[model samples]
Target: MKMKTAVLMAAVLAGGAACFAAGAAELAKVENWPRWRGPQDNGSTEAGRYPVKWSGTENVLWKAELPGKGCSTPIVWEQRIYVTAPVAGQDALLAFDWAGKALWQTTVGAEKPGKHRNGSGCNPSPTTDGVSLFATFKSGNLAAFDFTGKVLWRTNLVEKYGRDTLYWDYGISPVLTEKFVVVTMMHQGESWLAAWDKRTGALGWKVARNYKTPVENDHSYATPIVVRQAGAEVLLVWGAEHVTAHAAATGEVLWSVGDFNPGGQKNWVAVSSPVLAADVLVVPYGRGARLHGVKLGGSGDVTATHRLWKREDTGTFVPTPAAYKGKVYLVRDRGEVECLDPVSGKTEWTGQLPKSGANYYSSPAIADGKVYAAREDGVVFVARVEGKFEVLSENNMGERVIAAPVPVGNRLLLRGERTLFCIAAQ
Candidate 1:
């Protein structure tokens, strides 16, 4: 059966490679963010010189009010920015131009809001390949749109597959590779990872992920990221007390590390995605600050030998850590940021956020020699990435901020509770 599955996946990948080659080529030449974690899937951008300070009315280039609430970060491609929201009982996608003017808004599906406190219908961010935009919602509706807001293809995963049994809302953004749009749905019931053809909404491959973890630990709100290992791109999926690396061309498991929940804690639900720095994959186990670094390359069950380092003091619950310049920065839930050396897992420096008692759900964005960390109370603390953790600026939006800040060109795009602000140099 395993041999048959491998042979089928290889045939599917070979058939779709030619169809998506042009789109993949266009994606490589585009400088804008095409996915959830910027160009490289690590929350870092090459565009430098963002504004050092900004507020509700100060240093703000343009501010436009969104129709409803969402936690998904805005993605930029070429001259437009795309974001998803739940507006008037419908899951909608809103587009804005580089000037901050609202261009178009298209309703994708009926809103199926989650029952959790921080849950929303439109939690997953969209992905693009310089041609069309792909978005998924908590409604299980995944759709594709052109640059002018015209719907190309649409499908509902819950209706075709099974209903998502997630505790909170579905927040995993769609991952776009060379030939496939991969989506992972892992929850209490039947969990699976599936891939679809990027142009046509046809299913390419689906694989069931079986695990023996506790019920609560069976959920994952994290997104999948691609990493290059041994001359091949591998998709990294984290959930159910394990970090598994799958072949990007096909949904075959390459390697997995299952020691993330050694104590068998049931409530250690994974919220943060794994951040890859070169060949080392950093996996963060929720609630305990338990982090493990696994060296890439190897076959199945490499947990014992490939595990390089483990640390318990630097674990984070909500926000995903950012890696830049050979250092990893972790933002704790209660407004503390710590920088760790990727090699030895040693703390370089620890700094406190501007506002105390404020929770940070947004991941940190590292670029232009600074780290931008947003607090739940709408204050974005910008600190220098160099010598002694010096705070460069603290800009408050005066509204709740849940989405991570995105840096494009020379501006910082900040999505608050009800407004999107473009901060540039005055």
Candidate 2:
């Protein structure tokens, strides 16, 4: 009778495990843009269709005028949309509902206004893990809030660490991993990468990320990315003349690639973040004609051997590359778009996007077999991700746009200079 009871208990536990696995799989299919670069952190989404054509009035579902200006992209989770703005001399994180109603706005820290021409205090994008939202500002403040707008915890990195000395304002967006909110603070003075507990805002680990580069070249506005390799997850931090991978659990430097800024140009700042495609990781350097493709699963400096390929004359200056469906899409600062093979770094196609009197700071968003590249002067050129460089539509938002468009479900969220416009099918 005792043996029979043990068998029945084992069967019950097995059934419970199966149910939990199924629930996790179902949750992954919910389609939520929860972070700086969407769910995958590569500026691409599987949410499928998004409206290709939108004007100032046509196909725009709703437009909410923000209090002040921001260049960070809006992130969405379930029915809530969160964005950061510098309003009334404060760095504020605003929340909105699905129907474009303002839910709540909370002041996170004092605004350290950008000194550069196109920079802002709220340049870093906020990231969410569905339960809590994390935001960072140029003031070096990091805050966390629950989905219902309750402030859970807040801390200022500048208070703990030293002052940031970047040429422009700090713009590296926070990355939320399963266990921590990882942040890379690379600048001219006392650079480091630190991770904090997402729930309690406690420091989990910190590592000094000093790089032996020129003063101006030490500044990096690129964000860190998380990638999975060999059944283990690794966090990648790009900038400071190298691309370093850290162990996601302990903040240990696993490997690095340093040939990106070989000649040590004083003005070579890393603006674009690394994008991972399958087993290859593409790292872009500013003012360079080539981008490096490093193969994953290495221990030390893999610059000599692990490099799969390098594409000359094909690097982006400001916009980060997007990888989708085995192809990497790059939008240059001067309105040029190139699609290259991820493994070999071979150019598949290249063409110029529609000019809007300015350059591009926003990265390309790939969804529904289309690549959406937004220009600084408020024009978004939607092109097909197929044979040839065919443009499907040219969308004009009629305002200065610097943030990448967020695609969720059948709608696209575009944050311009003063308004957040939601575009959907008419």
* TM-scores for candidates 1 onward, in order: 0.90, 0.90
Clashes of each: 1, 0
RMSD of candidate 2 to the true fold? 13.0
Ten-residue segment with the worst summed lDDT in candidate 2? 6-15
lDDT of each: 0.77, 0.77
Which digits, one per residue and each the tens of the lDDT, describe model 1 over residues 1-426?
011010000000000011112244433443587777788777887556777887655677778788887778889998688998877988888898766777898887798875543546777888898878999988889998998898888899988987887656678889988788889988887888998888998889999887888757888877888877777878889889888889988789999888777777667777887777756777778563788887877899988988889997777777888888777888877777888877677788899777575667778898887888887778898988767777888887888777888987777888876788878775
- Lowest-sum lDDT 10-residue window in model 1: 6-15
- Local accuracy of candidate 2 as per-residue lDDT tens digits, 1-426: 011010000000000010112234433443678877888777887655678787766777788888887788898887678999877889889997766778899997799876654567788888887778999887988999987778899999889897887656678888977899988887777789899999999999999998878756777878887887676678988778788889988889899877766566566777777788876888887453669898876888988888888766779767788888778888877778888888878888888877655777777888888888777778888888766778889887877777888877667888886788877775
